[model samples]
Every structure is written in C-alpha cells, then in structure tokens.
Target: MPAFGRTMLTHWHLDPQVAYLNHGTVGATPTRVLAVQQAFRDDMERAPARFLLRELTGTFPAPWRSESRLREAARSVAGFVGARAEDLVFVTNVTTGINAVLQSSQLGSGDEMLITDLAYGAVTMAVHAVAQRTGARVRTVSIPFPPSSSGAVVSAIRDALTDRTRLAVIDHVTAMTALVLPVAEIAEVCHARGVPVLVDGAHAPGSVDLDITDLDVDWYAANLHKWALTPRSCGFLWARPDRQADLHHPVVSWGRDKGFLAEFEQHATHDPTCALSAPAAVALLREWGWPQVRDYIHNLAWEAGRRLTARWDTRLSTPEEMIGAMVTVPLPEAAGSTDADAAALRLALLEEDRVEVQLHASAGRLWVRVSAQIYNDITDIDRLANAVRQRLVVSSVESR
Candidate 1:
C-alpha cells in the first residue's frame, strides 16, 4: 500500500498553502489524469473535424477505428462500476443525467414523485420544475438527520411510498448531512411498491464500493468528477434495459431516435475530453489499490467525526457504518445557527484559517462536513478544530 496523508498531495495540483477538506463538493483531479485529458484535447485540436465526428462518435466511416472513442471510455467506466457498457453513458454531471430521466418520465396530474428532504438542493429544484410542468405533485420524505440506524432510513422511504407515487428518487450518499444511505434496501422497498427508483449517487463513485448491477434500481446517476478522480464536469447515467426505451437526453439533438447511447453520447457539441479521459482516472485508482484508498479515507473521516464531536462536546448520532469518506460534525453551540451564520463561518475558515470545508445550517444548528481524501491527514483535522475553537472563544468574549 502507498503512504497516504500530506505526502500524497504531490500526486495532485492542490495548493499547499490551503487545507482542502471539501473534496466531495467538487473533486480535485490528479496531475497524471489531467495530463491524459490534455493529450486528448491536443489530439482533437490537431484535426477538429476528424476527432469530434469520425473518432468521437464514429459518425463517419473511419478505417483506423473499430469503435468510437466515447464507447471505449464508457466501457472502462462501466467495468469500474460493475455495469455493462451498453447501459451506461456519460453526462456533464449527475444533475444533467437526473434531469434526462425526469424529463423522459410520463408524469401527469395526480401523479407523485417521491424524494427525501436530504436530496441535493439543485435536484430538489429540478423535481419541482417537472412537477409544475406536468401538474404532478412532489412528495418529500423526511428521513431523520443523524439517523439511528440503516433500518430507520429504509423504513422512512418505505412508509412514504403510496399508490400515487410514480417515481422514487433516493440518494446513495447525501450531500449536506454526509450520510451513506442504504440504497439497495430502499430500492427494494420502492420496487415492492411498484415505483421506479432513480438514485443520485453523486458521492458514491470512488468514495464507496459501487456496483450498479447489484442495486435493483431503474436508473442510477452519479458524478465521476467528485470522488472518482476524473476531471471536472464528468458524470454518468446507468439505466436498466427496460427503462432505456423511454429515456431521453435533456437536450434534443440529432441522435434523437437512434438509441439511448446515441441520444446521450452525441448530444450537440461540447468538450468530450473529460469523459474520454475517465479511463485514466480509473487506471490511477487501480494503481493505488481501491481497497487501500477507501480504507484510509474512511478511517480518517470516522476519526475526524469522533475527535471533532468530542472537542465540541457534541455527539455523532449517525453510525460509523453510514459514513463513507465524508462526515458531518456539529459545531459548538457558541457558533451561530443560521444560513447566514454558516456562510460567514465557512468564509472565515477559508480566509483566516486557510482551510476549506463544507458547512450548512440544519435542524437549528451549524454542522461542518469534512471530506477526507488521500491528501488529507490528522493535522488538517486538528487545524480545523483549533480554528473553530478560536472562533468560539472570541465569540464568548464579545458576548460580555
């Protein structure tokens, strides 16, 4: 196994001056993977027409190529997630893929789409937009923050499903709360209720051991950029064979009726280097050993949760098993509890302490979501703890 921690920062181009504990927000790509993406871009520049049309999608006959470049990259990514290449296609991000599924669905008046209160905020907006367009109702299932157990999560979703529920969207790992949900069990419950399941696995690609085939869901949308070490703006959508027929890309293009792959892969024209270079990211994962990487980060996140809660005199109500590479720790009560307060503290941490992390106000308190990566170590955690502690001391003095 390779040595992980501050030393591992050499593999990426992250600034040494700042401690970045926000990998789950927008991932940092390794220098090696960036080089690979640059090479693809260089090749495209050399022959724009041939590379984008002939090589990318194989729109024209190219004697030198047997398959399109996009398909080859898709195959590599499919293998990493334990899904067939045909079932997976790349998108700009998880939001784009989820929007495709939502737009394709045939919802109408009296229909309901089930989502949780913990779903990503942007996704919640998209669901509401669809609801407004089709006269469908959006039902939000409230899963308790800091859930007691995995069974509790499953039960919440199961109880929320009703005959009117046309589709159920679940998060494999929630964003703000940093909880790794029991998606398989939740999917099973939705299936029993005759509801199609769409999972937003934005943080699951490299954070957790993922196998799309193993989860019984109609659609799975995730980001390779966040945890998978891919370049920014790369994500994928996997659909069951039966579900593919009704799926459509969010943007209508020439590949409208060809097939699912054609619809998504040939959607207008944009930068394809990110998706084409996905294999390089997967290669790096294999080089480092996936199990070793996951173990180190997960352990780091678990320890951070324990240490921070102890320092703040708070409790980590969420079980360790529900944590992946990111853990949300409650701030000291001295820290103000409001959206504005959360933003101010987050900015203060970045500007004054040189630390970057995700923070949010939830359930009338402020919580920090710390993302543990190979480049982070205990010292980074300690830095954040001290920074917050100092703020609390200052606040106490000011109150007098």
Candidate 2:
C-alpha cells in the first residue's frame, strides 16, 4: 500500500482538526473541483438570463464546441462509467434517480418489487411508496450480514424472485453494511425471469470500476458526490436503451415529450452547476490516477476492519472480497446497552474524540461503519478504532 499522505489531504477542504472518516455518507469535495464549481456559480450569477436560457438551453449562437454544459457533463460521466451519453441523465442524487424510476415504472396490483434488507432506507421507502399506491408488494431478501459470497447473494435474490415480481432493486454496494452485492449476476437472473432490474448504486461511481453495459441492468443510478470528487447534489441515472420507454422524470417539465433525454435534462429552474461540475471532478480523478486511489482506499478499509474486529472483539459485517472502500463491524454488546445507549455512544465518539463514523442498526443490532477515501489514511482509522474501543469499555463498566 501506498501512503496517500498529507499531500493528498491538502486536495480537499476538510477540517484538519477532525478525523473525517465518513466519506460514504456524503463525500468531501476536492478544493480544486470546488473552485471549478464556484466558477460555474459565478457565471450563472453574472448572466442568469443568458446562462439559463441560452447556455444550458443549448440555444446560444456559437460553434458546436460550445455545446450545452449539461449534455457535455452527462457525456463525461457516461464515458467514465462505461455508458453512452444518450442513456445517462443527471439527477440530484441516487435517491432522486430511484424515485424517478419507481414513480414512472408501471408497477401495479399483483406485481411485486424484490429488494434486499441491506438497501438504503430512503430507497426502501421509495420502493414501498410506489408499491402501496399501485397495490404492489415488496418482498425483501434477507442477505446475511456478512454474506458468504457473491454467489450466495445471487442465489438469495434468485430464490426470492417470483412470476409476480415485476421489478428488483439491488444495491451495487450496500449503504449500511458496505457489502458489494453481485449486481451483474442478479441482473441476469431477474432479466431471465422477465423482471426489470433497478440498481441503487449510490456508492459505486468512483469507488468501483463500473460498466453499465456489462452489468446489463434495466436501470442504474449512482451518486457522483459520494465517490467522485464532486460537490453535493450530483448523480446520474442510466437506463438501458430498450428500457428507456418505461422511465420518466418525476417532474413533468418542458423537456417532456421532446425525448427521454430531454425529459430528464430540462428540470425547470434547478441549478445545473452540480451536474456541470462533474467533468472537472472526473478530470481530477484522471489526473490523480483514480485506479490507484481506489485500490489504496480499498486496502485501507480492509486493514481497518481487521484491526477494529480484533480491537473490539466483534464479528466483521462483510467479507473482504465483497468490500470496496468501507467496512462495518458490530459493536460489542454491553450488559444493558439499548438502542438509546448506542446512539449516545455514537455522539460520544464524535463530540469527545472528534472522530466521525456511521452507526447503523439492523435486526436490532448496532454496527459502526468506517469509510476510507483519498483524504483518509491509517491515522483516521486508528482514531475511530481507539474511540470505539474506549466507548465500549466504558459502557461495559457502567452497565454493570
């Protein structure tokens, strides 16, 4: 492993006083890219009418090189993730993209939507909301906390599918447990069953090598803000060319009926800078050799999990091969530790130790997830590991 040292940390505008290990929650934007975003905002502010109407609208009288900023941004992201620009559209985030897909999907009575227990909470709600309104049912697949293998994940999803299952929402990389699901295999199984697959790939964009064409999913959405060096409210939705007919934006705007791409591209009056800034973010990744950065982070995550598992004497939540840039470990159970007690422990870790991490609950158990990114190194993980171990020790003593 390479030391992604202080030089790397200087790229981001993160607080030097805190050990910021929560990149998976909402990523920290690189300062260089943030500067690019500010330029976009400044341009937008300088000529609100000209920029919005002529520039983003793609009506300015200029050469083809001066194309629409929104479209060019989409093309850059599509190229990065191995998809055609025509098939990808920018959205606020993965949650919004999932909402758009679910809202437009023709799911109704007797139809079922299959999802895993590890799905993001907001996406789970989106699935159920559409199901409830259309008299559909959501069948959740209970994947083991530390899944045996990717094959086991595929098998679980395959066994859960039924003839009534109209859609399956799978995570490329899970939110809470941080396990990378076998999305490619799961998509093949669902497609064979005549079920459309929607992948909630919130954490996959820059963390994993993505080829939407290779996955062969009907619809896939990911957040650039999470892994890519982009600011907040940035993500893209990719639909298979054949499945574009089944998709629609949540908001009906001027782009409606113009075409599928048009429908999504022209959301009324929303700032397009987040989407436009994606290329700069992608450029940063290319300049830094993202492949190397991704590998370094993955190694950091795996090592942290190993150290934490040993320190806390708790089970690892996911297997090494299935993890990318994040790992979760169950908190040691105190004699009388309740949900409230776990919440307090999380606050203490942050307020007392200045260490930020995610506390996730599933099946009535609390798990702490640690994320590794370019800005993170061994010291950050050590801080989190020490803070958690200290808290558990104190809680155990006090509980008695």
Candidate 3:
C-alpha cells in the first residue's frame, strides 16, 4: 500500500505490461530469486566437474543451506497451520505428492475414499487410480454454492463419511471456488472416524497462512509455485511422521529404500533450483511482512467483488474467514454461452485487456476466480471487472 515499493511481478521474467491476477494457476517468482536460480545453473554449467562432482556429489553449502532454509520455510508454514517441520516433506508439487499418498496407501478391497465436488480435477484422477489398484470406492460430496459458514463445510464432510471410509481428500482452499475450507476441523472429523484426511492446499502456501505441523491432518500438500512464489513444479507434502509410511514416493527414484527422511528427501535427480531458492521465497514473504501483504490482497479482492455487483448479477462462494488472498466471484452465465464461448471470453481478457485472470466451469456454472497477490492492486482488478462487463454487454447487444 505504501507507494508500491515492489509488486511481486518484478520477481519473475513476466512482461511488465500485463496485469497478472492469475497467481492461483502458478506463482510468478520474484526477479531477485530468479537471479539466484540462474546463478546455480551457471555455476553448474561452468564446471560440471567442480560443481556437480567436487561440490554437489558430496554435501554442498548452497543445497545444505537450501535444505535448512526449507526447514525454516517449513517453520513459517508450520507456524501458521500449527505443525512441526519433521511432520512435513517437500515434494515437487501437489500432483506428485497426492499420487505418492494414494499409490503407497494400504487401502484394499472395499475401502472408501470420500472427496468433495470442490476437489481439484487432477487429484480426483489420483483417487480413481487408487480405486483401480485396490477395490476402493470414491464418494464425492457436493458442496453447496455461496458457502454460508465453515461449520456448514465441516458438516457436509462429516455427512459424507461412512463406516467404510478409509480416506478423505479435501481442500484447504478449493481450487474451483477459491474458497478456504475448515481443514483443521475436517481432520478432527476424519480422525474421530479412524480415517485419514489428505488436504489439497494447491492455493494455500503463499495465498494464506499455513501451519503444516499444527493442522492435525493425516496428510497435506500445497504448491509453492502458486502462492509461495517458487519456481514451477515446486511443492511439498506434510504428514504426521506416523503417516509418512502411508504415502510412498511417486517415482521410484534414489530416495526410496533408504531411511525415513532420506527416502523422501533424496529422491531422483531434479532441477533443484526451485528447492535451493526456497529460502528466498520464504524470505520475501517475511520481508514484505506476511500479515500486511495478506490483508492487503484480501481487502482488494473484497473491493473488486463488491464493485462487480453493480455490473452483473453475482454472488460470493468464498467465505471471508476461509478466504485469504484468493476470491472466487461468480459472473452471470449467459444462457447460450457454450464452453468455447467461455474460453474466448478468457482469452479476450488476456489478449485485449492484458488482464491476467481465470475463467472456469464450476458448481454447474461458469465463474471468474480472482486471485489477489502482493503484485495486485485496485487498478489491476478494476481492469478485469470492467473488461468482463464490457464484453458481456457487447455480446448481448450483438445478439439482438
């Protein structure tokens, strides 16, 4: 708010012209952090022998510091969600981490996995795969639109759980609605029924306050690339060390067959640049001041949502308490608007308006979910709201 010292945009190589409101898809890393990542790559290229063999093959300070920084980053994450560092494990992203839990889980014949309609599409496939391997059943709970309260969410999940339910996958923040769910309460409900809850926090890391260890859930994973502003394909999974054995590595990399931490940590060779730059990601959050940046984004999202009401019939599916930085506000669904039409509308926003936002089908209707990050301000969001209203008006007039 203070003279825009720096929007998160300058962090990455994104063009300065675009007003990016799509941090929910994947985060834009800070320019400073990208420099650090390049340095690592350059060092690797200059002398593969010196960097890879002499330095990397053994224990290197950068990666070691990276790992330590991960723990510190984990500490910040754990502090918000209420968890310990040892309880969480860093994986590539939510997809890989989710698969690890599903494939490795000992679910057998007749096991049931309860998920909600709000779950991410990719994660749903993972549950299906688990069901195929074992004769497990997948039950999807349909969450109501314009979510009333966190209690309603908890009740919906509780009603969905049956005697055969062995696992439950929910969202810390629903990808479709961009609404935050009561993960802590959901975990408690699952534990009471002797079931484990796996939370897909795809948008939680940088968008909201996350305390991995204290969340009290059986397993969880979130994308650092989205909210935490890490490089793409960077995310992690956290389990109550006891449940670590419940999920196996998605790939049979070198990390397997080793000890507990070693098994997950030392997995196959990856472009560790993202992991190495994690400390800076965490540092940026602190540097910007987490609470200040968080409130700033959330307030902007609320303002934009309220402003849209004057343009079209709308509603808020994301609750204020549950929502932090991301807000999914529904737009009027044109009666004859086909999927193709919606895609065109989204493209128009990008190509014509230069406003980076999201348009997707959800809750049997289409909605534009607005993500507010540090780089976003009122002007950026107002541009998106105006563009949508303008297009819809033009289409209606043309139809006549």
Worst 10 residues of 2 by lDDT: 57-66
Tens digit of per-residue lDDT, candidate 1, span 227-326: 9999998999999999998899989998897899988977688999999999999989989999999999999999999999988888888899999999
Higher-scoring candidate on lDDT, 2 or 3: 2
Q: Counting only residues 3 or more apart in sequence or on different chains, how many pairs clash (N, Cα, C under 3 Å) in candidate 3? A: 13
Candidate 2 structure quality by residue, lDDT tens digits, 105-214: 88779899999998998999999999889999999999887888899999999999999999999999999889888788999999899999999999998898888999
lDDT tens digits, residues 260-370, model 3?
A: 455666556666667656667777777878778777877877777776655667766456786777777777877224566668778888999998787776545667778
Q: What ranking emerges by lDDT with the best candidate at the front?
A: 1, 2, 3
After superposition, the stretches of candidate 1 with alpha carbons farther than 4 Å from their true spots are none
1 or 3, which is superior by lDDT? 1
Q: Which ten residues in a row are the worst by lDDT in model 1? A: 53-62
- Return the lDDT, model 1, position 103: 94
lDDT of each: 0.94, 0.85, 0.75
In order of appearance, the predictions have TM-scores of 0.99, 0.95, 0.90
